[model samples]
Target: MIAPADHLTPDALERAQRHLVAKAIAEFAHERLISPERRDDGGWRLTVPLGDAEYLFDAVRAELDHWIVDEDSIRRLVRGTATDLDAQQLILELQPQLGLSDELLPLYLEEIASTLAGSMFKIAQGGPTADALADADADFQTVEAAMTEGHPGFVANNGRIGFGVSDHAAFAPEAGRPFRLVWTAARRSSSHLALGAGIDEEQLLSGELSAAERDRFATRLRDLGEDPADFHLLPVHPWQWENRVAITFAPDLARRDLVLIGESEDEYRAQQSVRTMFNTSHPHRHYVKTALAVQNMGFLRGLSPAYMRVTPAINDWVAELAAGDDTLRDAGFRVLRERASIGYTGDVYHRTAEPSAHRKMLAALWRESPVPLVSGSQRLATLASLLHRDGEGRSVVGALVRASGIPAAEWVRSALRAYLRPVVHCLLAHDLAFMPHGENLILILDEHVPTGVFMKDIGEEVALLSARTLPEDVRRIVSPVDDEEKALAIFTDVFDGVLRHLAGILHVDGVLPEIEFWRLVAETVDEHAAEHPHLDSLVDLRADSFAHSCLNRLQLRNTLRMVDLADQSSSLMYAGRLENPIGRARIPQPAARETVGG
Candidate 1:
């Protein structure tokens, strides 16, 4: 990088001239090879592989003429002082080559004006003698002219350099003592020995000081505000006092204000003992005992009577089975057997076995069935109840039987056949017996039946099956049949019985009147079909038939009101019943009036 100003030698000037010439040649060559063509017909065309074409030749000739004229002007300016030349001519020739445009011209002019203004202001504020001021102003103008001519080489020879001007008077007194100058060998070798100590405003105005001395003089003039620049100046060096600097103490100083409280270790222990005694006397002790029971057993399944009775017993049996010693496992086996017998006998003895008893029995068998003889008997009894119920009961039974260590696939097959095939066949028979292609009954069956018995731990088992799709080493156990089939079978059984069995039971059970029940089924099927229009065919088979079945079930139960149940043909009978109500009211009124008169 070039210094801001250094005396330019003849050789350096010649080198700059040579560089400009070479740049001109390169520009000329580019224009010749890449210039666009203009046709006489007012169209533009680019000739392929432009190798000394006629258009390129004309472009080169034009560029050469401009370059030659500029070169002659530069030569004339270099021979004498470049100050007289038009600044615009030099800018036009050099700015475009330097990648500067007309938009940037104002910024360049502002910078030059600011530079000269700052130098004049600094000299005036420094209180320079008149002669010194004249010389500084003259030097500033000379340097400005050379810069405009693009002869940066000449500007250096004119002794103009940029440097910081410091004001000594502006230094803060409380901050330190004044700094003393020390002449070092390096400063002396650089021919920079003189240093200005104080200002003489009149002397700075005279052209007596050399450029170097004028800079030092300007520094002093700036302090007196006689030749101030556009910006402020700071002292060349500043002294700092240790006492003036702020020191921060440790964080613990703030922490000291916080008062420490609470019990010491010994007191804490004493308080804990008191708390223990109080807690024992509180009603919470019952809750604590119950929580311990649950922890020892397991979490509650549900709060219904069926779940409440079975969950604790099941948990206790599970804990026994999980015990490490044979004694505990045997104890667990005994408990399981007892629970299973009690559950099975409950159905026969009390004849009011909770629906979940079969489920509990199955859960017990699953917990205790590691020993074959004991587990097998439990499995058979549970299976018998489940199958006789047409596998309509709780899922826990099938899960328990499958989970048992019965060592017999036939038993598993029998359980599956009993639960799945019978339900599926019944659904198929009912659906086909009415509407042969109907699949709606299948959907109803799945809703009511236990998913686990049919799908077999569906949440866990399905995921296990999906893993089997991978390579052998990575394969996981899964069901032999696809989940869709399992799901379909489960659903079909439930739906088949929806209109036939479930609606009938609901009527017999008297939970909902038959007409209301049919209305609900109709509304549900219609809304479902409307939402899923694609299932219309399947829905159509069941919609009407199922509604009819619900009506028939309502009739059989005699729960539907005569007005609500009667067909058009039976309307007269229902009308007669309405009249009977009015007649009955009249008979009661006459009796009441006769009693009042007497």
Candidate 2:
């Protein structure tokens, strides 16, 4: 067994704190949460209201108001004396500026500490360098495990508050250890299972479990005085089963409404999204996503049972639409649909007035895995790996460009065609938009060049703003977004949320300049527009600027549930207008913009 405290070394903790502090400074500055004044030495200085506390760092003001701060150059000062670059302490120093309420300050601090600990764990593990991860021969899971950065935008991205050190070691995605899922049989009357088109319960079960394992679970149900035919089998995360279900639903277990079966025969590894698991033993099997009652990022990471009921239908609708569209099909884009889902209703939790963690504890969904989709020359990697940098500051994307033996500009263009082209087509042609962040995509690479992408987490993240007719069951995805803010699905979610970080990484790593990067993006959009002249005028890609929807601001206001998933538009927190890079790139330059940091 790995020691729980093995990774919590002093050196690792300090390094983690430094990197996190730099990220906090950069993101907070981008959101206009804090202003750092320019210094004579071409650096920036931020003096907080807290007694004699200030931060000094060298930074470049990139497009979209992104502050590309040098982590190594950061120095924390008090009374003109240097101190350790403590991330938690920096939060306290900037508490007044951050607009953290008295009630929310400590809770946010706990989350920061949790994020720091996760960073330390990753530092201690020290698996693969960015160069190795960039290789086409590297396994999909290896690249997933090597990723240290969670969400590039969110400072406290890894706040798994419910996890102890032991739980972190056993269940966190960074651990990358294979473990069997805890299986359970819930009485048919108290549970619901939804399957996608043409798939039956038997087919789902047979695919997930071997015949002997199925017989073992059925016999266990019989021994418990329950008929196997009268129950539905559910796979659960071991952490959730032990930490949440065992105690919270003890009554249901005693009443024989739910019975513990055996564990899964096939071992599974946790994906970047902690609740989701990939079948390592049987790579072709479906990915199982379980309800994890942990407070991570902005919400309690739980799958809703009510939402589960319509998941398959929503996925089915999206898949059929994608398959029939020639543009999307030609772009090599695919949606990894959630094929089946099962949720158990406990009697005690249903009595609550609102949807809480208790009510969301027992649901799980099986999404089609992207493993079998790749062939001989093709490999799978998380899109997040594109922004990854090793301890020595060598980037995975830079390594991939070198390995491909292609110019950085051409590689970026290929990436745009594979990733961004489909996204733009989906929005204009189909009136569909996905929350296509790094973690949500499986980037398909052929000999270190991006060929296509597999989009997952479909049921929760997809949005349909179209007025087109749809079946009643699939209407849940229809979001009534305002016309002006509609483009923000790409502008805010894609540009500021993802590409801004990638641009910074590429610029900093010396692979590509920020100006040329945005030029290629603008060129890609222009080319796509020329091809599809009958596109919807929902939002213009050539607009001067768009609303700056701030992620950290939402988290700062409500550390619990930042935004309701059902109506994401209503809860948006915006900073000011961000200058559109694409719009600027379209104009002929009188003078070339100088590269700042790189």
Candidate 3:
């Protein structure tokens, strides 16, 4: 918990506050929550609801009609009075525009505060410039930590709600320190392990835990009035144990349904997405995704027991499909699968047919780490890294282009073909669409050029657009998606949610012209369409513009309550359709014919 730097210093705090204010202003505007008056310089200005306060910023209206604002140009004024930018007050000023309910406003403020603090911490833990990262051969963890912007869509992305300032300093991924995980024992009757094909309990336990460590865990269970064989061990996030499990699950502990075993000897580093931990101690061990009952981004991040039971089989189904496909095999697109999962159902919580955050409280899954899949010549970086910009305004995307020694557009084309083609193939050929956000996908770099991609973090959001029956084992993932909302998965999630920001970043960086950038994206989709015509005609319709489901609006509406993950497809809130930039780019505008003289 050592201070990364002078995090509390006035200059750092002001910078963090101002940065968030700018993001909030731009995001709210883009959501159509507010309309700022256009200024003569082509920038925009806003007077707060109370005429006492106002904000002025330079911004450009970009594709998807996003307000790409210049952070440095932001100015805040108050009652003919002014101070260095204040985000806390800005939240109150935009309260009407955001339309936050009274009950949720205070809680939302906490998220905003935590988010601002995270930005402050990042400022404190400054690292290599984008130029340096672009040129250097950085390891996965090194490059992961360098990523500055947390979720481009959400302004308050790092709101680790349950954490105190100290907890944030210790466990936040940006802290960049390894810590031991606390282990606990759940009685066999209270918990269950869902094994992957050919993976038994013994092999699973021994792989993640050494013999001596297993003995230690078993002995601790025996010391209590329980047989070691009657209980299964579960790893809990250290912060969760200290703040949640020990306090909230005390009754389970008293009945010996859950017993506190000591921390694991192996140290783990928190990955970019906070709850998932990378096994730093054993380089090739499975990455453990744990259930932390904290609100992050839009919902409670607790892993559902009902959902956990089916992860491995779903993953196996995906892997099997990929192996059988010639195009996917040749494309080199691989999924970093969730191979095994274990869940502990508290007797009280399991009484409910549906899963609330309470039922989701204690569970963990083991995702296959990219470590073993990685070779020495090949490197890995999260796709999110491309969005990172250093203090000098150089983007990681700019750096990667330079490092690859390829023309910017050429590098982008290869990266797009590697990423977009697989996603498109899965949709057209298999009726599957993954959650294609940055953190969910890993960039596979061979000698600084993106060779392929590894898709991770596929859960309920991986939609099945088809009504056709699936295998008995994998049927859990096959949900009926309406035609209207089917393309929203790819269009909203991939095109608008992810590529919108990427296009803006690259466009601003001058790495690619805006039209050419979008043209490449359109071309990639058209090529995929040309290759796969046998699947469904809807592919062309989906590739063209589709409905825009407003994701941030869902969070704003229900900040505290569970978004009802059980009925996930129904939970989305839509603000009407956004014209797909790539779709429009792909359509042919008829050429004008020359007139003949009489």
Top candidate, metric lDDT: 2
Instruction: Give the whole-model CA lDDT for all candidates, comma-separated.
Output: 0.23, 0.90, 0.79
* Candidate 2 CA-lDDT value: 0.90
- Judging by TM-score, tell me the better candidate of 2 and 3: 2
lDDT tens digits by residue: candidate 3, 1-598:
4534458678888888878888888877777777889889877888888447888889877887677889999887776566578877887877877778888988888888888888888888887788777654777887777777788888668888887767777777888888898999988898988887878888888999988899888888878868988887888998889877888788999999999978888999888888899989997999998988778776777888778888888888888787798878777789887878878986576877764578777889888888789786888889988778886677888888888888988988988888888887887788888888888888888867888888988654565777777877677677677655666667777777888788888888788877888778877876776667576636553344566676667767867652665467788776666776776445553343456982
Which residue segments of model 2 deviate by more than 4 Å?
Answer: 1-3, 584-598
Q: Assess every candidate by TM-score.
A: 0.14, 0.97, 0.94
TM-score winner: 2
**Candidate 2 per-residue C-alpha lDDT over 1-598 given as tens digits, one digit per residue, 9 for 90 to 100:** 6455888899998899989999999999999999999999889999987768889999988888999999889998888999988888888888888898889989999999999999999998887888899987899999998889999999999999999999898888889999999999988899999999999999999998999999999999888788999999999899989988889898998998989998999999999999999999999999999999999888999988888999999999999999998888888899999999999986678777876777899999999989888788999999999988887778899999999999999999999999999998888887788999999999999989998999999998898975667898788898867667778988998999889999988897788999899998887887888778687576787788888899999999989989988778889999889889987544432343356884
Write candidate 1's Cα lDDT for 1-598 as tens digits: 3322222334434433333332233232222312335457543222223121121112112211111112222222232333222222333444433333466444433333323332232222223222221121222112111111111111111111111122212121111112321100111111111111131322322222234533554454445444333211110111111111011111211321111111111100000000000011221111000000000001111112232223333333323333443421322212221111001111221234444212221110111121232221221121112211111222222333334434223333333332333333222222111111111111101111211121111111111212224333212222233333232222322332222222333333343343444344333333333433432122122311111111111211221121221121122111000111112222221222234557
| lDDT of model 1, residue 233 | 16
Query: What is candidate 3's TM-score against the reference?
Result: 0.94
